[model samples]
Target: MVTDTDGYIHLVQYLTEHLGIFENSQQQATAEDTVMELFEAQLAAQILLVCGQNPSLTFAQRNLIIREVDSIVYDLEEIFASVSTDKATPEQTMFITEFSGLIKNLFDQEIAKLHLA
Candidate 1:
């Protein structure tokens, strides 16, 4: 979990530095959507890191990872639900798709690790 935490912090820093670029791009015009997309990406990266670290995780660590992933997914879903139709944009769809892909990749990796283990 220590490595996962370090990786998540690094990803947050990287995303923070690159957020301006992502926002300025034509893909995301509104600040709200941009912020949400950035958060989704950050969460996705954290999940990826956690999954990558799962192979060596103890039972307690596995439980922690599951809890963290569930929390992130729940929060993300709530945010998606709260987005008004007026604010709904193609960027949100793209962001969600990308985030989902990251999650799927993490799950796949974790499954592969389990098979190896």
Candidate 2:
């Protein structure tokens, strides 16, 4: 799961440096929600990456990918539940929820491809 973690870290850095995920949302977000969203985005991005790269992997690799991605997503969901107590600004909530949905959709699209693989 080193690569998975690295992908998450990379995503965090990319968001900080390029996309301004943190900066854009911080004003509207609770500290916890911002962090949670980062993890969510990382999980989604890695799922998409793994699904896209599935062809290079063996059956074992596919299973590993599924396990790792599922684990990360599960962990994020748990964290989200815990931090969800804080209320965000309406604008921030909208941004976070919509963006979260978009990432989820992206992940779903990629995961769907796994069946074909």
Candidate 3:
């Protein structure tokens, strides 16, 4: 069986390749709301994978995951605020908003599952 970290790396690689968020040309652009959204989503996935698999982890470890997720959310909010009106295309903005929501849902689901077990 694959370890949680290995699974996360595979998932991140798959998401990066299929989502085209940070592809060759895409990386040249300055960081944007969409880029931050993708980054937060990846972080959330990592947290979910870790917590979901290691329910027996120490309290400190769980707190660390929560702290990391909170930091990502804060950074994402900063990115959203800094986007210029002209650069914040409607489609891109919408995608980021939806993606962030999906990431949050995944986190909630995983946490709930842990509690229920």
Candidate 4:
């Protein structure tokens, strides 16, 4: 699992950076949605991986974690939605997507370990 929280902070920073000027609001909205979706997926995967790693966790504990993750992500979405995307660098956007995938792969590795063990 991705134990470091820096990835999450960087995601927020990259997303807050202004994006390319869109031809229309629809285009901008789509770009924002894509970025947010990838971010949310990464967050969920990391949290789930951590919860899964602890085999001793009770059902209620697992459920609590899931619910907390969902709540936190929802709050972040609201915050990110308000950030203006007037001029984002391509590198920042690319990094967000790529980093998200990398974290997810880490989570996947943890799952594979569970099965193999």
lDDT of 2 by residue, 1-117 (tens): 432444455543443353333333434654444455555655566556655755565677567666755775565466345443444445545445554454444444445565576
The lDDT, on a scale of 0 to 1, for candidate 3 is 0.52
Residue 33 lDDT, candidate 1, scale 0-100: 46
Clashes in candidate 4: how many?
Answer: 4
Model 3: which residue pairs collide?
none
Q: What is the per-residue lDDT of model 3 for residues 6-54, given as tens digits with 9 covering 90 to 100?
A: 4334543544454433234333444454555554655566667667877
User: How many pairs of residues collide in each model?
Assistant: 0, 0, 0, 4
lDDT of 4 by residue, 1-117 (tens): 223356555644654563332223343343434545656766666666666667766677567556655665675567656443333334445655565565555445544555676
Worst 10 residues of 3 by lDDT: 1-10
TM-score of 2: 0.37
lDDT of 4: 0.53
- Supply the TM-score for candidate 1: 0.39
Q: In candidate 2, which residue pairs clash?
A: none
Candidate 2 ranges with C-alpha deviation above 4 Å: 3-46, 83-117
**Clash number for model 3?**
0
**Candidate 1 lDDT tens digits, 4-91:** 4444445335434543343434444454544455555566666666667556666775676667666655554554344322232455
Candidate 4, RMSD to the unseen true structure = 7.1
Error of 2 at 106 (Å): 18
What shift in Å separates residue 48 of candidate 4 from its native position after superposition? 2.4
**Order of the predicted models by lDDT, top scorer first:** 4, 3, 1, 2
